[model samples]
Target: MSVTPITTANLLARQLKNLINSGSLKDGDRLIERDLASQFSVSRIPMREAIRQLEQEGLVKVYRNRGAVVKTLDASDIDEIYQLRALLEGEAIFQSMNYMDTETMARAELVHRLLGSASEPTQQGLYNREFHELLYRRCKNHRLLEMINGLREQIERYELFQRRLLSDTLKFQDEHEQILIACQHNNPAAARENTVSHILSAGEILKSYLLSR
Candidate 1:
């Protein structure tokens, strides 16, 4: 689903995001517009748009005359992203506890089950993305969503990277299920703490991966 055969930038961006998120086009990887366009059977224009989207998300950097390259995030980047997510998404999750309907909650639980049952880490990663997106859908804060989306983008590779390296996704699943249960209880404090702990745990795992790299 992330790898689209189309040439449009939106599709290209989505597919490229998925690649970056899934650890295919890893940190510091150069993304050639021509090669990507050729691979996707599209034109340069859409590929450029796709690059721009990644640029906005802080996943890719563009130079004056050169093409784009995936960012090799350092400690500062992770720190900033985690701090930002703490302020914005922590609130979002707290607000979401009050706003979520039973159907939506059930859907999120379904995502949890799906993530647990996924055959591979890649599928589990995708499920993780969807699960979080669903959790914050009721926040009613467009700017907050945008910010969290970028933060999530910044950490995607680390998530997949750590899981593959450690071969341990069950821990993540356990944490998420706990967070979801907190939401189910309609307890804002519990949801916020659980969410913060979840993000912090991810930061620690990702920190290990970054240090290893």
Candidate 2:
């Protein structure tokens, strides 16, 4: 039996990602590499690497001589991110249809069930991503998955806000059900359409809410 080794940078990245997603690292929060290194009890190299990875994911901005700051999304940025999500995720579901087996469908069903029962918006968001990832991951395109996950991460804060501010988590779960059912029935066209609609609808709601803020 072999276990994959977790690199220091990977560990640091995961920790930082959690902080960002949980709103511990608010938008525009400065991230000092030396301070983070000392806080995490790791060397500066891994800390810098983790910050660089987050920057690549659009979660961090590196400023000359000012270290890194958490990235802030404006209305247009949110619109573009969600639009790209709708496009890429719809395509991912379309391409994954042929590769989705009965077992994978079953797994997606289980994730959907869990998502449906999640009580909190934050937890629901986690299960929601899991369910969608299960459906789309079989696209067999690493680059596409990377892009999708990046967009997903970029929307985490807004998702949490939406979930808490609205009573529409159940509505979102219903759409997830529709997508999963389409996948189970081997209807890629329906799944693709539902996936795109689901993303765009959520984006509109979030965009309106954000603009009102």
Candidate 3:
């Protein structure tokens, strides 16, 4: 299999994406080409390309004369995304549970352990994604998986904010364990319910934070 080449633009895009997801780059922050290029020791061309890539991912918006600014989601956007995620991911996990094996369960448990131990918000986010992806990996519906991933990406910034600003990480991890237990017991219905509950709970916390700000 041929590997995709990583260019300067791709590297820059990944860095910018991480910054955005980690809450270092706040919503509506401008992507100043000159400043970012100097900071990253790159040319303006790649910086422009990087911002364009983030724009494509719905993380950045570009206006005619204003360059790119980080995209901010409103309360409605949060509600819609989380509602869709609850439905789609709930279904995905239910379907995947039908095909779950010992190995997948074991791997998921490992990821969950890692997630609980992860101190940094970014590291916790990564392991959390891995744990959920592992649980859903056995689902045969590739399109469904793609949709779930897309929705998760859209709300990731909010998730990072929730982790950093709220005291709910431990509560969330407890919910994760509950989901894992349901999956391990081969109870698809309970797993689905737990998964949906976990997502909606996180969404509510985020929405409350956003509105209070």
| Tens-digit per-residue lDDT, 1-213, candidate 3 | 999999999999999988987789999999899999999998899999999988887789899998889998889988998999999989999999989999989999998888777788767777878888999999999999998987877777777676563234488889999999999899999999999999899888888988988
User: Between 1 and 2, whose TM-score is larger?
Assistant: 2
Candidate 1's residue-wise lDDT over 159-181, tens digit each?
75755632454778888888898
What's the lDDT for candidate 1? 0.81
Q: In angstroms, give how far residue 157 of model 3 lies from its true place.
A: 3.1
Q: lDDT per prediction? A: 0.81, 0.86, 0.88
Best by lDDT: 3
| Poorest stretch of ten by lDDT in candidate 3 | 160-169
Clashing pairs in 2: none
lDDT of 2 by residue, 37-151 (tens): 9999999999999999999888899999877999988889888999999999999999999798888888889978886666787777677778888899789888998889888
Candidate numbers, best TM-score first, in rank order: 2, 3, 1
In candidate 1 the C-alpha lDDT for residue 94 amounts to: 80
